[model samples]
Target: MKALRRPSTAVNALLALLIVGAAFWGWTLLKDTDSDTGANASGLRTLTVEQGTVTKTVEADGSVESASTATATFGTAGTVTAIKVKVGDKVTSGQLLARVDDTGAARSLDLAEANLDAAEDALGRAQDAGTDTSSATNEVAQAELAVDEAEAAVAGTKLTAPMAGTVTAVNGTLGGSSSGAEGSGFLDIADLGKLQITAAFSEADATELKEGQAATVTWNALQGAETTGQVVAVDPTATTDDSVVTYGVTVSLPNPPDGAKPGQTVTVSVITGNVENAVLINSAAVTTTGNRHVVTVVGTGNQQETRQVQVGLEGDDAYQITSGLTAGERVVIPTSTTTSSTSNSNNSGPGGFMGGGGGAPPGGR
Candidate 1:
């Protein structure tokens, strides 16, 4: 019965057509996969090495602040009698700022002087009568000390500026108690001419910072406003917050633009390294191999060769090629996507090419 079923010609012809269609479909899939591989290989990017300047910089956010500031307050507490300076008044050091009532201080000074005169007369009388004068002499010395303290108390009634600056605040007013302005003092002054920028940089970035390093500052409030500054100080200790550590850096702006004021936000860029007339190439084209830097250079006829290169200044975008590469040469930038796909096809563990236990690939620096 099974042998009788092979006599049908129509069924055999249909089977032949089905087999052909299956083979064609299989061929199309294989062709597509090959095409995809070719496209990915052709997508490799290349760059031409050239001579230029490479600069390495560290950027941070900061705020403008006054370099020097002072606060003036009265030395003695009394009724505020007068205020000599107002807010925005420019005054020099030792200038009187305000005065307090000194009636009690002056009375104490007069009484102390009278007591000292009486004690001295008693000491002279003791010596003339040939009696021990030690007790009388001690009384005269104590009276003299009281007089000096009373004089100091009277002088303390006047509040004066400790430094030359424009008065930014005035807390005292006529007839007010001097004790009322204890917290902020009677006046606050700042030297606005000397401006500085205070910025916090990550511990990793702060290692390259030092005093006297040049910096460029850009104001966030003012468009197109910028100025040059110098690094005046770097904190010796790190400040930690939420487990993140940073260092405080102070930059002095010698010539600030007009309208620049304290508390304004700014961006600071410090040039850490610079090289001129050096052979440079895109950092993406270089890869680290063990202890050497390797690059894929494309030569004539589209041939490629991997060679070791000596990298000098590792800039933000480009690398300074010190040797093993000349200007006008083309270097290939390895495409991660293609490399990753090839690695997966071979059943390589979780990481892709130059990944896993391997070191960093191109552009890692």
Candidate 2:
């Protein structure tokens, strides 16, 4: 048989061209994928530093409380004979809230009166006989003292409101035992004339607070409703619970809205300090390096320079950059795009589509 005809050069050239074309196509596809994954990408995200007022605040949560409260109880223990007040009753000072048994007080008063009469008779007899009446006079004075004591005991049996307020609780019942303690009080009165918020702050935050500092209180139950207040008191003593020490802070709400009741949860933000016309940046843009805080600054040519930063009055998410950065300078931060790319890469395997090989932009996440 004739020797197998070798493929011609023209045919070979076409086959070579097809193979090279396929290789080039595959390489282009890979290049496109790498670009999409942000590998060696030129796009960079930057934030424009701004100048504004930055306020340093201490945030705390606490419950609304009355400015003053009074729990009325008997000074002496006795059988509860009557309850003169009920919950929600508005009372004035000296108003009777309850009454206890006064039978013993009555008997004591009668005995004292009989003694006084006998002493007076003896005194008259001594005067008539022209003997010394000093002993009889002393006896009469003693009897008068006993009578006053008996009268005070009778008054003590009545529980009276110490101040004008609304009765919040009544714990006394007819014929019930009264012990003059909290749970056995005849009534509980809360002075609703002025409202206040009591919050506890950590020792570190409490140090920054002082009396007369401005505060903003937002009631959780009343949406969009807030009241202005001032720091009235900061207890020098710290209260410790569960190994956590917190200082008590009292905020006075001079004009709390109606319907704001005691025991309502509230959030308070106390303005500790404020800097006007200060360079500010996002707090997250800061990164710690060695002993100093630093931020990546992006220059006009997209060149990055890590510079040391001096910060002051750090707020919730913004920071007062005192030095090392100025207004209008662009600083690199972890952009939302970079975050999305990283999240996608994490969920999708390396071979998966949309592979973010690099995952972040330069100086970004």
Candidate 3:
């Protein structure tokens, strides 16, 4: 009597499965509805058509460097006697920047002078001796050579600035000892008035980068200062650093305000493309079904048709459709409901829009 009839486990399991199945079915429907929130929602092989206008642009990065870099060193073998210019000193070309002790050099010069005098006296006496004076004149010439050598040594006692710039570094101190014949620089002089930017671009990006392209640069050193410049040069060879092979792009900075220096960190902006009044299509909407651009165009009848469009330049925010699509055409822009579309970049045809086929519009001016 106490044990009443109870439901079997198999019956309960069947009911549980029906409940779970319904929950999954409802979830799928909710996801599909979320994808279409507006009247002009987008989907695969589709683009939300935008108005048209032309565009111009390029993008790159680089650092600010000196136009002219000069390293001052010991002209002759001697301990550094004095350094006239310190870091940050504005020096002009040919200005004295450093001095090596002339004490030994001057003594050598005196000795040379004495020897020259002795030779002159000997030559004078030899002329008085007569008939044998020819060889004595040769001795005068040899002594004169010694004097010239001594004079040159004395001239090298001072280090002069080779260009108009600021002193950026002082290597060794006076009496600390250093022969600058090696790469060790006694002082560094850099012309900040003429700043240059050394930019690095990937091989793919380098195709868009070229000399004479306009650029804007910014630096942490010069707060609030935006620098304007142009691409001055491009390295023909590729350089590999940190596993990235890049081409060097040199940009000539406009005359910055006084106080610019070399080795300062700088950021450069090279706009790859800039567009105006462009037929703005969300990049996700455009799809490639093999050598063809499949864009969904919505008509006044609310019918969605997959239109074969001849697309053009592709960008981050929009695609440039040269043909196959018109201004104010309603193309469906893809959303989370579908996957992003690919482009037929390698397709060979006049009407084939390839390579993520949205490019900056062509400008007349």
Candidate 4:
């Protein structure tokens, strides 16, 4: 049998070159893969964990309404006489708001006065007689009673204001009609300065709400300005309107300026409580898993740790981390990080690559 011939040095050199090149190529491919994978796993996430007040507010959108609202209807019934106040008139207590005709009342008053005088004269004469004057005594007593009725009738002819407030509405037009009473007002009065918010909240959500519960208010008319108040009253019964049940909530609003009217809708936000001295963090940093709360933290240089956090309250974009975080420690915002699918190995070569034996074997000799 003939011996196998060995190739020349040039061919040997070329073969060596090919081997080196193959190794380099393999390492390069792995380096790219590792790099890609690492990029996916570890990312730069920016977070905001600072000191701030975290209010647990039950937020709902509603409209602004007059705090001091009133539907003024006269207590005594009468004809629509002369209504002195208009829609925006300010009235003081005891001010004469309107006048009902005193025609019948005046006539009755005059008659009663005459009857009462005649009664007094008969009573004196009967007393002087000092003997069986029972008939005159009875007649005098009847006349005295008639006088009282007449005086009462005249007193019922004037309409007066019951409260010092703004005239929000006027029910009857002057010279329109007349019914007949005293103290019956055709005008509505409301104290705009002492306004209260009457909000219609869903009954289910309003269960925990009670008197003096702190709240914040917003208005469509006044943007960027919020007022604070307390829950003054709550109606337990559900106010159902067309199958939708709601509860009436009264919030004492801040002192308002002059000329405020009722029936305007206002927005109310009931703040149940506040979390103080809490470890606040961006809401985006939080992640949930099967009722567990967690957050991903960026540790020392490309290292990341997942930690469980105790949360107290949640705002629109922030959360109160009651535990698991400290001041000045960094966290991820989740927005700054990007996820990658592939990973690259940067363990071997200069820029990051892989090398020989444990890797894929070359072709057979």
Candidate 5:
């Protein structure tokens, strides 16, 4: 039998080179196939026009606050002799909240009263004698004024609830100086039964908000807790912080759920515009050209036409089609193409479609 000859080094090297070339060719074909598949998958996405409700809303961060609040403090400076209520105590208007030493106040009141009595007696005697009583009458009037001031000072020693509310904070302690607490008063009371949300919204958002606009509030502290409210007021003036302008908006929460308290953060979404039973379409399908809006409509036999449309209230995700479109009509969302060549030419380095710095992302309109 003839001995089989082993392959030469040159032949073996050539075979290895051919194998590498075949593998590279297969890889190239596979990459091309994937690119074609991706292009097909991204093409011709369509949405059907339908009759529905479209609501446009403006969202803002806010905090819960009492609609009615009163800060109770002693009008006259003195040591706090009594504290009738503690933090969290419910109180009514005119209810005694705290008391200070009234000794000096009472003495001043008594002295004023005695002076007024003496001055009035003098006036009466002068009048009975038919002599000039102008000076005596003036003295009586001055004394009466002093008496009124003294009475007011006496009443000022006792701090009373100015309105019905729950005591949120007590700054003064028994035996402490009533005047020691400054700025915030001795007691902080808030009408917890009546709550409202105060939010600062951007100038653009505030323009759309008006009194009586319906709103929904969600608490951050309370998981999944939400309630309805109404726009009670919008500030005419703008508040500036770091040169950024915003307006204050107040929303009344007629009936808030339990656990909602003042200072708790909340999210407020006010429905600025709403339309029911209107023809609506995906906002992405509409493109603005100059001053007109247009959409790509797909009809029978896959016929496509670019038609001008009248756009109405634009919502978060849907747009109200005022005209030029009807229910059951299909509209195409233009495909976003980002090939390697295009991406390199645009200098948009990786993550082509989104990172390209193009128009607003899908669903952003």
Candidate 6:
């Protein structure tokens, strides 16, 4: 050492002041961090469980089609002389829809009628003269059969509607021979008022659906049109398309949207189950722990305990508590913010707290 010298009074006084200032700053930082930790520890959100309704549903999409449809083809080959009904015309059963050229058929009928009259006269004369009337009788019967055949040929040229429905297609042309080609049908008729949706559901979803179950139908084309319907039929056999197995579930709409035509696509929601007056809680409150449903419940004293629960009728947002939980119980709804804050507090360095274990400041009462 160069010399043993005492520090000046001013220098010693300045060092003392600097040490106190540094200590105060460190104290302020510790107090702030402690306050932050206390606030975060008590900041936990909770939800009160109560009675509510939950509806379990199965959703699928489908297209709307006529419940009953029919296509009328020509019965006989002839020139389409007249087409009485046009597309969209409502027709009744046995209504005359179209007619063909029956001139040749009429002529045959007339010729057959004349031959039958002559044969009857011959039979009457034979009976009056008593000369072998049996042969005349046979000739008259043959003439009667020929007339019936001619009448049938004439009737085959006319086309008629088989049922009462709206005409959807008309493929016949005037003066065109009824060759019955691809475009040769008289017309198509369908019962538009009675509509149905053939919805396809996956194998797992179809199992819960049964005939007579209620369903709701929606179509984008109709602008939020919703109609009540029921499941009319479910195909027992499954249909596979593009490696996906699905089943056809027929839902019938008793009253479809006005002007809703066939082939419009629709979505179907089938209600499988509805639970009422059940204890419900937020779905996030439920957690799976080793084959058990666990939920964290906060007691009156602000203490938390994990308990196993039985859930029923899972809904879109909440779940029904079947057992191990009751109405009016409070359940904890964990949040990311609270979790992050807690993690930061646990990972705090040695300097974070007033003391290592949140002890009082140094030299404090």
RMSD to the true structure for each prediction, in A, is 12.1, 10.0, 10.6, 14.8, 9.0, 13.2
Q: lDDT by residue for model 6 over 11-83, one digit each (tens)?
A: 7899999999999999888777645444324555555565666566788989988899887776666788888
Top-down TM-score ranking: 5, 1, 2, 3, 6, 4
Q: What would the per-residue lDDT of candidate 1 be over residues 21-114, giving only the tens digit for each residue?
A: 9999998897666443332244545656666667788989999988999988778889999888888899999998899999998999999999
lDDT order, best first, reads: 5, 1, 2, 6, 3, 4
- What 10-residue stretch in candidate 2 is worst by lDDT? 348-357
Off by over 4 Å in 4: 1-52, 61-81, 131-146, 179-185, 223-225, 255-261, 280-311, 314-365
Using TM-score as the yardstick, the better of models 3 and 5 is 5
* Residues 1-365, model 5: lDDT tens digits: 12333456667899999999999999889766544332223355565676666678899999999999989878998889999999899999999999999999999999999999999999999999999999999999999999999999999999999999899999888999886466679999999888999999999999999999999999999999999999999999999999989999999999898898899999999989877777776565678878699988877776889999998888765678899999777676656522432332223111111111122222222
User: What's the CA RMSD of model 4 in angstroms?
Assistant: 14.8
Q: Is candidate 3 or candidate 4 better by lDDT?
A: 3
lDDT of 4 by residue, 1-365 (tens): 12333456667899999999999999888777644333223544344355555555555555445555444554334555677778789988888777767777788789888887887788788789796677878887888788777777666566677778888767676665444223543566777677777788886668768888888777656556667888888886777899988888888877543443355556788866565555565455577677678877666675667888887777533567778887545555444322210111112211111111112111100
Candidate lDDT (C-alpha), each = 0.80, 0.76, 0.68, 0.62, 0.80, 0.76
TM-score attained by model 4: 0.61
Q: Which candidate comes out best when scored by TM-score? A: 5
TM-scores of all candidate predictions against the true structure: 0.75, 0.74, 0.68, 0.61, 0.77, 0.65
Better of 5 and 6 by TM-score: 5
Q: Give the backbone clash total of model 4.
A: 31
Number of backbone clashes in candidate 2? 0
lDDT of model 6, residue 120: 100
Give the alpha carbon lDDT tens digit for every residue of 23-53 in model 2: 9999999888655543434565444566665
Off by over 4 Å in 5: 1-42, 337-365
- Model 3, C-alpha of 214: deviation from truth (Å): 1.3
* Residue 316 local lDDT, model 2: 47
Q: State the weakest 10-residue window (summed lDDT) of model 5.
A: 348-357
